[model samples]
Target: MTQQGARWTADQVLALAPDPASRKAGSKLGTAGPWSETGSADEGTVWGLCKGSGSKPYQTVVDLADAAGPAYKCSCPSRKFPCKHALGLLLVWAGGESSLATVPEERAPEWAAQWLAGRRKRTADKAEQRAGQEARSAADPEAARRRAERRAERISAGAAELEQRLSDLLRGGLAAAEQAGYGLWEETAARMVDAQAPGLAARVRELGAIPSSGPGWPARLLEECALLHLLDQGWLRHERL
Candidate 1:
């Protein structure tokens, strides 16, 4: 829905379920049997009325354009973040023209229109607020430059320190590093964190996974180490780059 009229896959819709039970329950209602007034909009909204045990059918709506993944709302009493009705509606929507029809904005039911209008308004507000903040930050160019310089200094220091550690590890032999296991990498990653170098810390943390990555791990580890070493060198000499 977010990328033109491209419909979601069944697996993608099912993946949003809070748990296996929700997936199972939601799957049962995916067909047209228990649903009516089911429709989707090109603007990434899906809504339907699902027959429930109660006399009145439950209303379910999904907003695919929501920044935080697909947002769901259903009149059902289920406490799940995405109630079964919402999941079913999404599942039906994912099936494309054969399963669900597209209703024009003006033709959409009152309840669904109200919710969609509110959501679009809130999303617009958030975008406007973010633009204002970015404009304010841009207004103080000197302060922005100073902040960038401080972060660069920290990253440079982290890179130099990481280079030294890699040199030591290679000198002591990769077998020793394998024996040292995750502990060595975790400790090194902590130092990168202290330096406020999130990128370096993340790379170091990933190195810890190499040992348990099955056969030929040593070769894989060595290759990754070479790349990390190169990254460190590049960061250290970024001014020349």
Candidate 2:
């Protein structure tokens, strides 16, 4: 079946954002004038470059047909969603700057190539591994059950530890967490990893930022906590799935 075209718009682009900082940064960079060029190739890749604040301009490229969303990398220090650079580049592309010639001779930089290759390889490997696992499970129901049980046990232990940590954080209050710094979250995340729950560990690390992230941090932290709780609950109940 054929797929639908992307509904690209400034509002749609901004809605993909998860934070206000990214929106503000995107607005700032969007004023840097029109893109030099924009275009989509036969392979479904959309590319564009726009002027940035520094001496070097920002580059943005997206595979509109890919379900994984756009790939973005910028020289900016802001860890905000899409970043200002990405937003600016997308703005130009979504506007009327998408008629540039194909530049076949322009090769990707070593770093970009390496990163892209690694991502592709990792995704391919994961798919292959999952397929293999499914095939094995189809042939061996007992083995699959044992694996599921083990995973459930590990997840349970990780959830318990995370609950304890959250309780400690609440008991001490948000101010204490700020004084504890990133090391506290890193250490907690490490513990979560050791418990075989890397996903939970990642969320824990993200939660560490709330204390130092200015006003309304409590609300943000609570939201993250609720997400973590949901993850823990889901894993505990749906391990077989």
Candidate 3:
């Protein structure tokens, strides 16, 4: 599990089932009847031997340390990511099924131990990769700073252009806006998109939507215009902001 990972809820366990039939099958097997030697480790591993139609019992192991979610391995014939037995094992553990017992982390059986080793290696590799990325990013500080400055300048220009458009709309009075429709706003928004100011472009698109809005449109228009002016002022005072 990743650091401070949340425990899986019962719904989350069931959600892993590939189908409703699998989920039902898994839920039924969640009790202690078909399982033996059930054990969980503090380090987030669960394992059990499940009796099957065959003479031999199937081995099921779940490694909950996976950052994405618990991972499963079952010697049963099912091809599911978590075979029914694995799901049953997790569900049983979740239900506090009487068969299970807690043990020290190092007490994992050989099969589970092998899986845990692989999980640890994969986790270590990911951590190392992230560390390398951070190191490289730190090494190129000046380039990152220049990129940020350029992006801020583009946003500032976009904000200024949007401010001018809003001023023109107010002077022309929004009543005339019924005739002068979305084309003007779409063109302005496209320019903002070209300037790489997605935030401003999104606001412009919202403004374009106001005319077609059936009721109390003038109020909505005024409110949106005020917000546009706020963005303009924010960019003008970018250093303080």
Candidate 4:
């Protein structure tokens, strides 16, 4: 798995993408060929924008400070993971293209800068607030310890429940999951949400589409199920990770 704050490289980003055809198409559409400017820190997120084929270019953002994993939201219609646009943008940034342009003085278009200033300010404020909270908690260690214990207990319980559900799904047979269709997946997804596993819930929802996915439905379903099982096991064993 990719490590947080690992400093993405051109080859690494390209490797995360699906295929060359998709990458070429995205480049043609001006989705992710090069960067105008790039910014990041050892403990900070990386942010950049790429020219897209649509009316506006796509925004590529990576929060390296958190291990939650990278997120990409492109305007393109492709559904592949780390879509080619995201891969290309990361590749450009990783290639040390930050010096190409000085920071823009005029505010970027509204949509582009909407979260920039606010997020920076919020980060600063949150840091200060957390420091104050830490000082106070240190003075009353017992209370802090209790809170930590309770939070850990809740996370453990939730993970255990998720594991049991996965085992049940496997033993009950995933073949039936297709027959029940979207409703089954949605119901399972709701349960995942309640368990505070929204990512897994989204994964489960995607599984619903495999049945009608035409060729190799069985193989696809099995692959997705194996992935789900892996996620469940990972979460159970390493909740903090």
Candidate 5:
């Protein structure tokens, strides 16, 4: 249905009733005979006081701007969501611009005003919460990107250092590796660990075992060194690959 000063028909108002009893009871009180202080405010809200059997009249209000159709509030003791009083109030408002209860007012009474204020505050709080979650969601990807870049830098530095160490080892001759023993390989692997290159560190540990493998150890050690050197070059030029 249309909103903002637009009025629903009597049939439409009754359609919102919880049951036949509510529809019937609401129709009976739809007239001006038992309603007072009735007024429609901005934002599709209508409120009024209905004379019940009690000393104090029942206060009823309807928020027509609700996305799920009209929302209702009544000071009655009924368990129904849109009680008869609220339905009756809507029916009275459905009478259109000429109805006594449809008179426009700049503000609702204290009771109605309080309910409206509470609803508005809740809605604003929910909106603010969603905005905060969205902001954090937006920041998370950027933080992840920075972390990845930092890791890449560490790996590249490790690879370059490894390449230089391989060059020095080859210049010093393959015979020097056997004399250097496991200590040289262990120290280099530890350096790779500091650089956050676990794969390189593992390969370095494997190289340390080759010197003790027996028979043609020099050829095996040279082959492993060639492979490790190729891996270091690949990492240093990863962007091109």
Candidate 6:
């Protein structure tokens, strides 16, 4: 609570604990006895190395940048979110019991820098995705429907053209395919791509790749060609289904 705001109150720190035991444990360690290399950077991220039972200190970080929300990360093996270490950190910083909680004049440590950078990137990506969704939601439904219809029409035309290619291949016999080379299939796939029929384009790409699909590839090629033909016919007669 009170993320991205001024220093947190003691009650606010306790309120975010995973359990009462965590809150009590956090309160005990809040005075910075076992904590070191502690400081706030960027006015949002507070971090420190908490000496625990283990020989190495556990790294704890709490994000208070959002104001609307807060997040916690710790290198300790606690199953709890905002584990004791994190809560202790919030307490240590907010209580201002130790110089460890002061703003660092130097750059953040390697661990804090890495985590903050990753968190920032994740926030940016989520913001972009949310913006896209909001834009789509705000778009005119009629215009969206018309755009979809245009895409469908283009796909249908591509499918029909693919059907013609499949028929020609069948008429010429599957044996000639071994000699036809991938160039012809590549061209057809490119045309389907241009026509906006990703399904047809992918089918053509599979056809191109079948020749090199190891031993018994000829049988595989025949099966795949038949499947493509069936897809073409199905699309052409979809109203019947």
How far off is residue 211 in model 5, in Å? 90
TM-score of 2: 0.50
Q: Estimate each model's TM-score.
A: 0.60, 0.50, 0.56, 0.44, 0.54, 0.53
Give the residue spans of candidate 3 off by over 4 A. Answer: 1-9, 142-241
Q: Quick one: ranking by TM-score, best first?
A: 1, 3, 5, 6, 2, 4
Worst 10 residues of 5 by lDDT: 97-106
Better of 4 and 6 by TM-score: 6
Among these predictions, the greatest TM-score belongs to 1
Model 1 agreement with the true structure over 1-241: per-residue lDDT tens digits: 6535578777656655656677789899888889998888777888889999999999888888653346778888999857789878887877764657776655778898898889888989979997885687699888778867887898888888999999898888877765664557767887887787878877886776576566797898789999999888888887898
What pairs collide in candidate 2?
38-98
Better of 1 and 6 by lDDT: 1
lDDT of 2 at 179: 63
If the candidates were sorted by their lDDT against the true structure, best first, what order would they fall in?
1, 5, 3, 6, 2, 4
Which should have the higher TM-score, number 1 or number 3?
1
C-alpha root-mean-square deviation, each candidate: 10.2, 8.0, 14.8, 9.1, 29.6, 20.4
lDDT of 6 at 29: 78
Q: Write the per-residue lDDT of candidate 4 for residues 77-124, one digit (tens) a residue.
A: 778655666666555556555442323423343443455456556768
lDDT of 2 at 79: 67
Task: Score residue 40 of candidate 2 by CA lDDT.
Answer: 47
Any runs in candidate 2 off by more than 4 Å, and if so which?
A: 1-4, 28-34, 41-45, 62-71, 99-114, 147-241
Whole-model lDDT values for every prediction: 0.78, 0.62, 0.76, 0.57, 0.77, 0.74
RMSD of model 3 against the true structure = 14.8
Candidate 3, residue 73: Cα displacement in angstroms equals: 1.0
lDDT of 5 by residue, 129-238 (tens): 97886677588988657767888999999888889888999999987776665557767877887888989987886786576567798899899999999899888887
